[model samples]
Each structure stands twice: as structure tokens, then as C-alpha cells.
Target: MRLLALEASQNSTYYISRYQQVEEFGADLCVLNGEGTEGTWPEDRYRIVGSKHIDDIIAAARAWHAQQPFDGVLTFSEASVTAVAAVAEALGLPTIGFEAARTSRNKLLMRQAHEKGGAAHPDYRFVPELEDALRAGEEWGYPLVLKPTLGAASNFVFRIDSPDEMRERFPQAVDGIKDMAWFTMEADGLDLGPHGLIVESFLDGREFLIEALAWDDEVYLGSIVDRVTVEGDTFDDDVHHAPTSLTPDEVAAVHDVVRTGAWAQGVRRSALHAEVRFHQGRPYLLEIAVRPGGGGLDHMARVSAGYSPIEAVMNVARGVRPEVDHYTPTGVHTAAMCLISRAGRIQEITVPEEVSGSSQLFFFKVTAGPGDVIKRPPHGNNILGFLGATGTSFEDAMSTATELAAQIRVEFTD
Candidate 1:
């Protein structure tokens, strides 16, 4: 199938890997970007509209479609979700609808939709300023989550344990969101609805990341991974393991909640990245992103569960129901984590042959290069890349992953 992936306001470089995956899977892929670096893709297959505005993007896409029609339109970006929906609608192609796209992209809208649809979620208040955040903190009490309305990869997300921390972090979040690539990369001239901070009641329990698909009145959990991250004030450090340890009953409960949340977000037929966390021994919907999960999650899904989220994306874009079923593990054990380090400009990153050439290694990618700034929490949740390994058990997998991670050295410019 001929597919077109849209990157409205292409602010990040990681999307190239996703586009390449489409081609590697034997699909004819083309890219349309509102704003992108020159030569990021071949001239024959890439087009830039030169403006990050919705109108310009639609016009450019319409012109391109008239010349060479695309069988499907899609995106692998949190920022471009709504833009792709708009383009697909304009071109008379299959879409999850613009309303679903908007609600999925904005946290405040998502919470409101979930509440209206009776999906279990945390109480949230949109805070536009520090004063608003302070009032929210007072009302919601301490140990609340302060996050941006339009956010991804946990950027500008903080766990406020006290009012003083709320006071200290509110201004940083306000300043950081101004330049946050996730927010800034959105196509202009759309009513994004509450483009600011939100204070949410925290869920204190284990978290699960699910790669799922939503069909007509049904949702399928393709791959389920456990978020084994050690919690901190900021949520930058993420560690994951699979096959998940959820009991069959727990998995069914998670599936029901995910289905409810997906319908609540008006996502009827699309690839979903649902994040569910527990509170008081019950699952609550954290989010339902209208795209596949990031990092080596696609690889994890294939290896650990015998499910292919990338293939699901392609199928959904073409308006075809993906071949998916309820969560079923292939009895494979793997562990993965985001490569994080202290803040600085990257000078060199070295992965020793022992780690790189190991047979247990399944996934590795260096996202940062020389001269790239690596920002940790407070500034941003910048990552070096991803590393995943397989083993006989969860402990063995995690041990191999961590040990190999330690051997991969990163040098920063002082």
C-alpha cells in the first residue's frame, strides 16, 4: 500500500526511524512535513509546506494528493496527531475524526472526555498560571501531578510532594512549555483547548504500557509491558519489562478499562498507546495516545507478544481491521529502558562490543549525537536512545539490560 505520513511542524529528528520502518516493512512511504530540515528524506518522497499552520498544511497535502493519491494518511507523532486527522479528512481518507484527534492530543480535553464517558480517571484542574497551580495544589492536596496540557515523553511533568515544590516548579513548567517541542510542533490555527498546565490527583501504584488497537466497539491489547521505573520527583527515567506479570484477571480488567477509555476519547478504530496505572487496587486511565508507543516498544511488542504494532498502524491507516487479539504472551522475557544521563552537550557515546555484539541484545539506538544537548529533568526529558535485552526471566533480562547499559559510556562536554 502507498502511505503518506504527516509530520506537522517537524521539530524532532527521531521520526525518521519510524518512517524508515514503514519502508522496511515493504510499504511505499511518503512524508509530508509542515516544517522540516532539508534533505531529511529523499526529494522524490518528501515534501515540506514551509509553514506550521493547519491551512497551509491542508493546502499542500491536497495539492500533493491530486498529483499522486495516497492510499492512507498517518503519523507517528504526538504533535502531528490532530494535523494528520485534518489532512485525512480534507483528502477524503480514513481518519479517527478531528474531535478524537484533538481530545487525544490535549490532556485537559482527554480528562474531560474520560469523565463524561464514565472512565475512571484522576481529578484534574487546568492551571494557566502559578496562582492557579497554587490554588489547585491547595484543593487537590500535596502529592499531585503537575503536567502540561499538551505533553509527551513525560516532559514538564513533575510530582509535587509539597506546596513549596509546587511554587518552585510551576514557573519552570510555564517557561519550559513555551519552548517544548511537543507543544511548539503543533500545527498553528487550531483550537487546541487549554494550552497550559494541569494539576491531577496522583495514582500511586504500578503502571502498565499497552500497545492496543480499537475496532468497532472492541479494543485489542496487542502487547502489554510493565513500567518498572523507580519513581522520583520528575518522571524522566523510564524502565520497562515484558512479558507482563499481570494475572489473567488483572489483564482482563486492564482491557476493559482501556476499551472504556478509548471509546471515551472517541477513538473507534485506531492504533492506541494506553497507559494504565493502579490506585487503591483498581486501574485508572492515565492516557490513550492515538499512536504506537515510543522507544523500542514496537520491537518489544513483536518479540515478547508475537504482535506487531507497526503493522497495526499501517492496517488502521488503510481503513482495514488489524489482525489482533487479546493480550497473549509468547513466553519471552525482555527489559528495556531510556538511556538517560546528567545534563550536558554530548561529545561522544561509546557502546562497547560486549554490549553491542551480545546475542541477548534485541534493540539499540543512539538518539543523540555530538553537539546535541542532553537535558534531564527540570529542563527536559532528553534521552540518549534506547537499549533492550532478552533473557530467561524478568530478573535475568533486567540484569542483562542494566549491565550492558553500564558498559555503554557517554562523554559530555564540560
Candidate 2:
């Protein structure tokens, strides 16, 4: 299959490895980006649109399609989902459709769709300003989640446990979103839905992440990982373990909720990254992204559940039904976390040979380097990268990952 991936966000370099993996999965891959560093992809297979405007992107893609027709269009970046959908429609390729893509990427639209479809979800209100946020907080009570409608990687997501907290964070989120990388990198002139903050009643229970597929009337949970991060005021730190510790009945419950959410969001056929958290013993849909879960989730899924989300992406992009099943474990235990550090410019990061070459290590990638500024909480949720480890059990894996992570030193300069 010949696939053309769209990434107008200018963050295309981060997914070079994924593009290579797609090629390794037996498909010819070409990338079209709005802006990207040279040498990120093979010159012959990569092109820059040189513009984030939808018209310019479509024109470039159309010209490329004429030279050699692409079988499908796809993207792993959240910021490019809508653009990919547009290109796919323009080129007469398989797609989840523009409306579905838009709703899935915008939290407010997703919530409205879910509500209309009667899917279980948190109470939410779009807060376009501080006054609206204060009003929402007054109505929802304390401990509400404040987040951007078009956010990824947990930027500016906060938990407001009191009026003072809400007052303090409201402006930060409002101003911070104006310059957020995810929002800024989006294609120009696209109807991106509401560009504001949403206050959602917090889900006070265990959370789980799934790499799923929705085909026709059926939605398959290909891989399920538990979000085992400890409770906190801000939703920055991410820690996960797989296969999930949920009972069979609970797993089934999650699947049902996710199915409702997919159909609700108008996602009939697509690769999904669904998040559900329990509230009062019932699962509530957090989100159903049109892409797979981020970080080392792909690795966790492959090692623990024997499911390949990347392969699913490839199959689904061409209007083919990916081979997926209900969540089942391969008995491999693994733990992964986002490596966090103090806010400053990174001078150096040192990883010992023992940690780098450990048998228990399954995945390790450092995203930050010299001169890269790391922003922690309140400012931004920047990270060093991701690290995942495998062992006989969850505890063993967590221990190995945490211990090794501590040994890797990071020097920061203000």
C-alpha cells in the first residue's frame, strides 16, 4: 500500500521513527509537512507544503497525487487530523470524514456529541473566559478539570479544587493557550471548533487508556493500559501499566462505554485512542482521539497485549478493516512513565550504560537535549522523554524503570 501522511504542525520530526515503522510494516510511506527540519525523511519521499493554509496543503497534496496516486492519507499527530481528513476527501481516499475528524479533535464538540448520543461522560461547560470558568466552577462544585478544547500532551490542564485555585489558573490557561504549540501549529482557516477552556467535573476513580478500532457498528479494544499515576492537582505526570488490572466484568464495561463514545463522536471506522475513567463505580468517557495513545503506549500494547496499533493505522487508512480483538493479554508485564525534570534549559542528560543496556528495558527515548528548555507544571508539561521497562510483574517493572530513571542524571541551567 502507498500511504501519504500529513503533518502541518511542523512537529514531523518526532514521528520519523513511526514513519519508518510504517515502512517496516510493508507499506510505502511518504510524508507531506507544512514545515519540517530537512533530512527528517528521505528527500524523495518527503515534501513540505510550505504553508499551513488548507488550500495550499490541498494543492501540494493534489500535485503529489497526480505523480503517483496514494492509496490513503493518514496522520498520527492530533493537530493534523482534520488536515489529513481534508486531503483524503479531496483525493477521494478513505477517511473518517471531516466532521468526525473535527469533533474528535475538539473536546467541546466531542462532549456535545457524546451528550447527544447519550454516552456517559463528565458534566462540562465551555469557559471562554475567567467569568465563565468561575460560573462553571460554581455550578459544578470544587475539583473540576480545566483544559483546552484542542490540547494535547496535557498542556495547561489543571485541577481546580477551590475557588482560589480556579481564579489563579483561569488566566494562566487562557493566556497559555494562545501560544500553545499544539494550537499554534494547526492548519490555517480550518473550522477547529471552539478555541477555549472547558471545565469538566473531575472523574474520581481509576483511569484506563485503550488503543482501539471502530469498524462499522463494532468497536474493538485492541489494547488496554491502566493509568496508574497518583492523584494530583495538575494532570501532567503520566504513568501506565499493562495489561490492565481490571476484572473481566470491568473490562467489558469499559468496552461498552468506549463503543458508545466512538459512535457518538461519529467515528465509524478509525484508529482510536480512547480514555475512560471510573466515577462512582461507572466508567465515563474521557476522550476518543482519532489517533493512538501517545508516548510508549505502542510499545506497551505490543509487549503486553500482542496488538499492533501501528498496523491497525496502516490497514484502516486504506478503507480496510484491521484485524483486532477484544482486550487480551500476552502475560508480559510492563510499566512506563513520562520523564519529568525541573523547568530550565537542559545543559546535559547522562544515561548510564547499565540503564541503557538493561535487559529489563523495553523502550527508551530522550526527547530533550542541550539548549532545550524544559517547562514543568503551571508553565507547561515538558518532559525529557519516555521510558518503559518490562519484568515478571507490574511492581517489578515499575521498580526497574523508576530505579534506572533516577540513575540517569539531567543537568539544567536557568
- Residue-wise lDDT of candidate 2 within 337-395, one digit each (tens)? 89988899998999999988988888888888899888877888889888999999999
lDDT of 2: 0.90
> How accurate locally, in lDDT, is each candidate?
0.91, 0.90
RMSD of 1: 1.2
Q: Whole-model lDDT, candidate 1?
A: 0.91
Candidate 2 lDDT score at position 364? 86
TM-score of each: 0.98, 0.98
Residue 241 shift from truth in candidate 1, angstroms = 0.5
lDDT of 1 by residue, 240-270 (tens): 9999988999899999999999999999999
Q: Which pairs, if any, clash in model 2?
A: none
